[model samples]
Target: MARADHWSDTEIALTVADYMKMFTLELAGQRYNKSAHRRALLKLLNGRSDAAVELKHQNISAVLRDLNCFWIPGYKPRSNYQEALATYVEDWINSHSDFDRVSQAAVKQPAFVPTGVEFSTLLVETPKPSTTIQEEHPPYSPNRAASKRDYVAQEARNSALGSAGELLILEYEEYRLRSAGERTLANRIEHVAQSKGDGLGYDILSFETSGQERFIEVKTTAFAKETPFYASRNEVSFSADFQDQFHIYRLFEFRKSPKLFSLAGAISDHCQMDPVNFICRLR
Candidate 1:
């Protein structure tokens, strides 16, 4: 065993990297729920915070999972990172989900893959399973289906009052994606959603002038006046909990042409955010 004091910074970072990969595997369903996983991690790392433990291990994993990643949760829960990441990579292109197109998109265009010291050490403890795994095909799969069905779909469905309410939302994504890719806007307004490895919710991201990062949970609706969108128990709690870093991006004028006006900071940071459904209106 490498003595604690003797572990070089690179080695230590690698160790944390390994832990992150394992955790991502766990999120992916890799199956190492050591009876005392968190405790064991703390002991192993000599006492690091849970978030730090999570970040250190799988920073990219967290990002992919948090915002809409290649893979979304699917019919069968992910058992390991490889399978989970594969699901995202494949995008359940083969599964019967709302975002078959999106899933297939990821499969065709693979994004992040682990590398160098991070890659070798992380794979060390991962178990190779014997059971034959079932994955979705090229354009439709469980991961994509589950993601839309489980999380974002219902809200979208409920808010889709008519054709106009509908077209704007889908178009808005295209609009944002196109806009985000612009060389000018890319640096200033980041839209990449960090994956929610632990299911903490939010869909988009923005950076503020204060050198602070803001997580924007976008809500789009065709409701005539201000519309209210449903948030998960986790989403609401996360906003209320992280009073400083979170904000709500209300996309109104969605039917005509999508327009966004943000309610920056916690539900209360600006004014009282009624405990009722999160309403989409101007500042």
Candidate 2:
């Protein structure tokens, strides 16, 4: 097996296309064989071993992550990818306007929750602490404007998907409590944002097994796990005041099968808190 320092334009394009195919299938809830895809991809790249092809796939995942786009979860994005790969991905995304259109279409349809169905047990990863201090205010797109566009277009404008995601969480919380024989607690679960209002700073009011209250703020997107989300000053301050009870449930790939990761305590402790907008007073 010969190793190349960099992938050719054709090779990168092929890998990106293959990845998109897998992504679309996965989003549609269709099953696919990763090994079979690798074997098939090998035939397209001359003298590239199974391992090399797999690494390239991981590289593609890294590029996607950098662009704030979703990568295949199985790939586990590896970094130090070729710069050209980023360009290739940007081009692919720019060409595919239908990608966003399709995702938006899915969002418009109501979220499907079957009656008497057991929601999948949620497995959440703890937010890792940052090693270095981040900039006070970082530009939305320091380099790749295309990537920035992808992030903003999907996350900000997709309101239906966001509402559906909150509904999913609300049901999950209620179902979880009921399953534990805490029917009273389940009954008490409140959709604060809907029933009360969005000014409450959190969406759902849930409870712990021991009957402790939980303040949950859900952020949902159809994009990948690494995509950035907007948080209001009110939400941040509320999290700070109620650090023990506040939680941010980030739902990624919401249009597909939604999976969540949680950040507890103050929001600033978990994320690089940057102020994107501010109110100005003209006296």
Candidate 3:
């Protein structure tokens, strides 16, 4: 199989379309087989091998991550994707209003105790910084768009979904502790956001298997895995103060079947932590 240095426009478009279809199915809680999709894609691509198509799918994943949109979970995002690919993905998103509509549609809450569950851990990867900064589009700019679908804004506004996600995590924490024979520690688990207030930098208070206290800050979204989240100055400061024990349980795809990935230690080490807002007052 010969490796092409660059993908043609038609190939990129076809790949993006296939990737989005899989992503939509995953979000809708519909089952899909990646190999089947790839085999189907091979027909459109001109003699492209399965591995080549797989890499292209990963490139599509990277582009979606840049756009702050969801990508198929099976293809882990890989960086250094072509700029043209990003443009094609952005165009597809802008043209398809239904994508945003379906993504934002209300989802039924998942069962309290999820049965037949398989957990896969996602380690947050450092997003490859764009070399060429494209002009800002109103809503869907890869960097910062003013659009309503802007993940950062959407996440801030969806309080009901956020709270629901936190409750799910609380259940998981208690279940985890009890399963490990830490029944007393499980009982001590507190939903600090409810008990004390949101002033505390963290949300739930659980413990390590060693019985050491773990300060957990839960950031959840009903959208994709790479959706951006807001963290306050207080939260950042608290994480720095308690780096050893601080953990961020990032819950995504919450409205349907919820899944999570965790970030531990100092926030600075894991996230870019850009300052998106400011507090100003009359002096």
Candidate 4:
């Protein structure tokens, strides 16, 4: 195959299959070497270079992101993928009978406090939105039954996962206060969502080093950093109402090694808000 030629259907299918295998292993917590996988995959491709294979894997990550599914952590999504790649990815998902079951199990799995966490590097910069020109409609579209299995949304509703993330942040906040020699403030930190209720829009009530109240909301995902999260209209409004006080502590890859990025001030300023739910009353 010429270097400039578009990937053949066979090549795309093989590549997508290889990517899915690695993704499944990562989700299942099984040990797998990416280098080894890439070496093996390269043998099957038509003289594709290592760099080409790497970019293709990143393209698969982009496709998975659009599908609202978990992707390999090592491969940061590259949005400049060919439309045919998206079609091949959707074909793989549709043909695999166990894809939904395996993914759902991974997303819905309960989480616990990860040990030996490096808090120093836990806080990362929030991801900037992609500037790529998206198509009028995405090329990959899941069938009706498959569309019902929205893994990202399902993960958002996982109370166990959400609680585990909140507890992690709660401890981090206390640590932050105590490390700054504010023991009294650390003691005053409250898991208000647990003590009070979930309607408060924020999960934990913490404090700034200057002794101001800091309201925190936690969103957790078992996937890569760029995975989109759901927020309530109430939460958005509350963040806008108390922009200085509100913070979003996003924890990702919680089932494995956990790391987080925080978005402060109004949530809308940090994220592009979308309305995903509705209320209906008899008129």
Global lDDT of each candidate: 0.41, 0.73, 0.73, 0.86
Alpha-carbon TM-score of each model against the true structure: 0.31, 0.76, 0.77, 0.92
Best candidate (score: lDDT): 4
Q: Give the TM-score of candidate 2.
A: 0.76
Summarize candidate 4's per-residue lDDT along 1-283 as a digit string, tens digits. 3567577788888899999988888877788999998999899988889999999999999888778787899799887788788878877887886787788888888888787787778888778866766654544665545455678899998999999999999889988899899999999999999999998999999999999999999999988888889999889999999998999999998887889999999989977666766898999
lDDT tens string, model 2, 56-160?
877777676656566676675666566677677777776777655554454344554334433664545754554436433322232644555444445555666
Q: Return the lDDT, model 3, position 117.
A: 40
Which residues of candidate 1, in runs, are more than 4 Å off? 1-155, 158-185, 188-198, 268-283
Cα lDDT of model 3 by residue, 137-235, tens digit: 322245323133544455555667667767877878887888899999999999999999996889999999899999999887766666668788989
Angstrom error of the Cα, residue 73, model 2: value is: 3.9
Which candidate ranks first by TM-score, i.e. highest?
A: 4
Candidate scoring better on TM-score of 2 and 4: 4
For model 4 the local lDDT of residue 34 reads 91
Task: List the pairs of residues colliding in candidate 3.
Answer: 139-147
Query: Which regions of candidate 3 fall more than 4 Å away from where they truly are?
Result: 1-3, 106-148, 209-211, 222-228, 252-261, 279-283
